[model samples]
Target chain A: QQQVKQSPQSLIVQKGGISIINCAYENTAFDYFPWYQQFPGKGPALLIAIRPDVSEKKEGRFTISFNKSAKQFSLHIMDSQPGDSATYFCAARGAFGNEKLTFGTGTRLTIIP
Target chain B: DAGITQSPRHKVTETGTPVTLRCHQTENHRYMYWYRQDPGHGLRLIHYSYGVKDTDKGEVSDGYSVSRSKTEDFLLTLESATSSQTSVYFCAISRTSGGQETQYFGPGTRLLVL
Candidate 1:
C-alpha cells in the first residue's frame, strides 16, 4: 500500500505563475514531511520540509503548507521559472526511529516560458 | 554536494550474473540507504545501514543484499541479475535516524540487465 499519495502526475505552469503540488498521507505516525526535487540524470535533493507542529514553512520561493488534521500537505512555488522544471517527490517518515521514508509516486513539473 | 559518490555509474550485465554497486561518502554520517528508482515507482528502499556491520532490509530487498564495512562505504550487491531488477540505484546519507535531518543523495547508478 502507498502510504503517501500525490496528485497530478504531471503539471505545467507559465513562467512567473504559481505552481502547486499536493500530497496526502494515511499514516498518522508520520511526523516529518519533506519534498525532494530531482533533475534529469541526477539524484533527488532536499527542497523544503515541514514538521507536524508547524502548519507552514517557507524557504525562498518554495513553501510547504501542511495540515495535520487533514493529513494533507501541499507545495507551492511562487513565480515559477523554467529552471524549476523537474521531478518532485513527497515523503513521510515515522517518528519512532524509522529511518525509512515512504515516498509518493512523483510529480513531473514543467515551467513553460 | 554532500560528498557522496557512486561507482559504476552505468552498468550492463546479463541475467544470472552478479553485480555490485558501491557508494562512498566523506560526510561521516551514521545512516546510509540504498534505493532504486523506476518509471512508475518514485524511489523504493532496498536496504539501509545505521552503523558499521549493521544492516537491514527495506521495502524492496528481495534480490538485493547490502554491506557496510566502514562509515564511509556502503555496498549493494545483486545475487543474480534479472531483467526486472534493471533500474537506477541511489545512495543516501543522513546524520541521524529521524527528526529534521535531511538525507543527501548521490548522483545514481544506472544498471541494465539483458
Candidate 2:
C-alpha cells in the first residue's frame, strides 16, 4: 500500500513564478513531514520539514505548509528560479524513533526561463 | 555533502550472481540506512543498522541482506541478483533517531542486472 501520494508527476513553471508541489498521507501516526530535493546524478538533500505541531515552516524562499487535520502538506517555492529545477519528494515518518520513512512517488519540477 | 561515500558507483551484473555494495560514513552516526530509488517510486528502504552488528529489515528487504560490523561501514549484499533489483541504491545516516533528525545521503550506487 502506498502510505503517501504526490501529485503532478512533472511540473513546469515560469521563472520568478511560484512552484507548488503537494503530498498527502494516509497514516495518522505520522509526525514529521519533510521535503527533499534531488539534482541529477546526486543524492537527495533536505529542503524543508514540518512537524504536526506546526502549521507551516519557511526557510528563505522555500516554505512548507502543513495541514495536520487534513493529513496533507505542500511545498511552495516563491520566485522560482531555473536553479530550483529538480526532483522534489515528500516523506512521512511514523511517530518518533521510527527507522523507516514513507516516501511519496515524487514530482519532477522544471523551471523555464 | 555529508562525509558519506558509496563504492562501485556503477556496476553491471548478470542474474544469479552475487553483488555487494558498500557505504562508508565518516560522521560516526548511530543510524544508517539503505534505500533503493526507481522511476515512480521515490525511494524505498531496504535495510538499516542502529549499531555495530545490529540490523533490521525494511519494506523491500526480501531479496537483500545487510551487515554492519563497524560504526562507519555498512554493507548490502544481494544473495542472488535479479533483473527486478536493478536500481540506484543510496545509503543514509543520521546522528540519532527521531522525528527531527535529518538524514544525510550518499551519492548512490547504480546496479544493473541482466
Candidate 3:
C-alpha cells in the first residue's frame, strides 16, 4: 500500500562529490513529482519538482532526472556541500484538483567535509 | 514562509483530552492544508480546505477534524488525543493557478500525547 518508495535511507558523500537519491512510485496516475528538503525541527520545504512532460529539470546545483516510463526519479546534487545535508522526500500528486500529495518514506543526506 | 504561523508551537497533552492547532495565514490563498510528519514516513495530509466552509479529507484523516470559517484561518482539532498521535504538524498554503502551485509551509507545531 506504500505508494512511493525511496532508497538509501542514509547517505554520506564528500563535500565536492555528487550525491544521489532515488525514488520509485507504483501508482501510474501520479502526474507531478516534487522533492522536499527538511531540516531538524523545521518543516519540509520545496526543493525541486518535475512534470511528466520533461525528462530533466535543473536549478542551480540541484537536478531532478525523471523517467516516466519506469515511474522512477532521482535527485542529484552537483558538488554537494554540508549545507545540502538534510532529509529529502519525494512526493507525487495526480492530475486535476486531486491536489493531495503522496510522499515517500525519506532519505537522510549527509555531506562529509 | 508565506506569512503562515502556527500557534502553540509545542504542546504535551494527556490521552482522552481534546486539542486544537491553529494555522493563520496572511496570503489570502485559496487552498490550505494540515499535515503530520513522523519519522521515516515523511509527511501525510490529514485534511485540506479549498475555500471558506469547503473542506475535504486527505490520505490520513481519521482521528482528526478541520474547519475553515474565514480565508485567513484553518483549525485542526483532535477530538480525543492518543499516544499514537504524537508527531509534528504542519500547515501549508497554495494558489490554484496554472497547476497545483507550490506549497509554502509553516514552522510546524510539535505535539505529544501521554
Candidate 4:
C-alpha cells in the first residue's frame, strides 16, 4: 500500500506565479514531513521540512503547509521560476528514530518563463 | 553535496546476471539507506544498514540484498538481475542528533537490465 499519496503527477506554471504541490499520508505515526527537489540525472535533495507540531514552515520562497488533522501537507512556491522546475517528492518519517522514510509518488513541476 | 559517491554511475546488464552497486560515504553517519526511484512510484527503500554488519529490509527488498562491512561503505547486490530491476538507485546517510534525523542523499546510479 502507498502510505503517502501525491497529486498532479505533473504541473506547469508561469514565471513568478505561485506553484503548489499536495501530498497526503495514511499513517498517524508519521511525525516529520519533508519535501525534496530533483533535477534531471540527479538525486532528490531536501527542500523544506515540517513537523506535525507546526501548521506551516517557510524557508525563503519555499513553504510547507501541513494539516495534521487532515493528514495532508502541501508545498507552495511563491515565485516560481524556470530554474525551480523539477520533480518534487514528499516524504514522511515515522516516530521511531531509526525508521526509514516513506515517500510519495512524486510531482513533476514545470515553470515556464 | 554530501560526501557520498555511488560506483558505476551507469550500468547495463543481462537478465540472470549478478550486479552490485556500491555506496561510499565520508560523513561517518550511523544510518545508511538504499532506495530505487521509478516513475509514478517515487522513491522506495530497498534496504538499510544501521551499523557495520547490521542491516534490515525496507518496503521493496525483493530480489535485492545489502551489506555494510564498514562505517563508510554500503553495498547492494542483485543476485539475479531482471528487467523489472532496472531503475535508478540512490544511497542516503543520516545521523540522529537532538532527537532529529535528516537524510542526505548521493547523486544516484542508473542501472539497466536486458
Off by over 4 Å in 4: B96-99
Candidate 1 per-residue lDDT, tens place, A15-60, comes to 9999999999999999889899999999999888888999999999
Q: In CAPRI terms, where does candidate 1 land?
A: medium
True contacts kept of each: 0.66, 0.68, 0.68, 0.79
lDDT of 2 by residue, B5-114 (tens): 99989999999999999999998988999999999989999999989999999999998999999999999999999999999999999744343777878999999999
Q: Which ten residues in a row are the worst by lDDT in model 3 chain A?
A: A93-102
Whole-model Cα lDDT of every candidate shown, in order? 0.93, 0.92, 0.91, 0.93
Residue-level lDDT for A20 in candidate 1: 95
Model 3, span A1-113: residue lDDT tens? 78999988999999999999999999999988889999988888889888889999999999999998899999999999999999999989887554778889899999999
User: Per-residue lDDT of A1-113 in model 4, one digit per residue for the tens?
Assistant: 99999988999999999999999999999999889999999988988888899999999999999998899999999989999999999999987766789999999999998
Best candidate (score: TM-score): 4
Question: Which model, 2 or 4, shows the larger TM-score?
Answer: 4
Q: What does DockQ give for each predicted structure? A: 0.70, 0.74, 0.68, 0.82
Candidate 1, residue A79: how far the Cα is off, in Å: 0.5
**Residue pair clashes in candidate 1:** none
**Model 1 spans with C-alpha error above 4 angstroms:** A96-98, B96-99
The A-chain TM-scores of all the candidates are: 0.97, 0.97, 0.97, 0.97
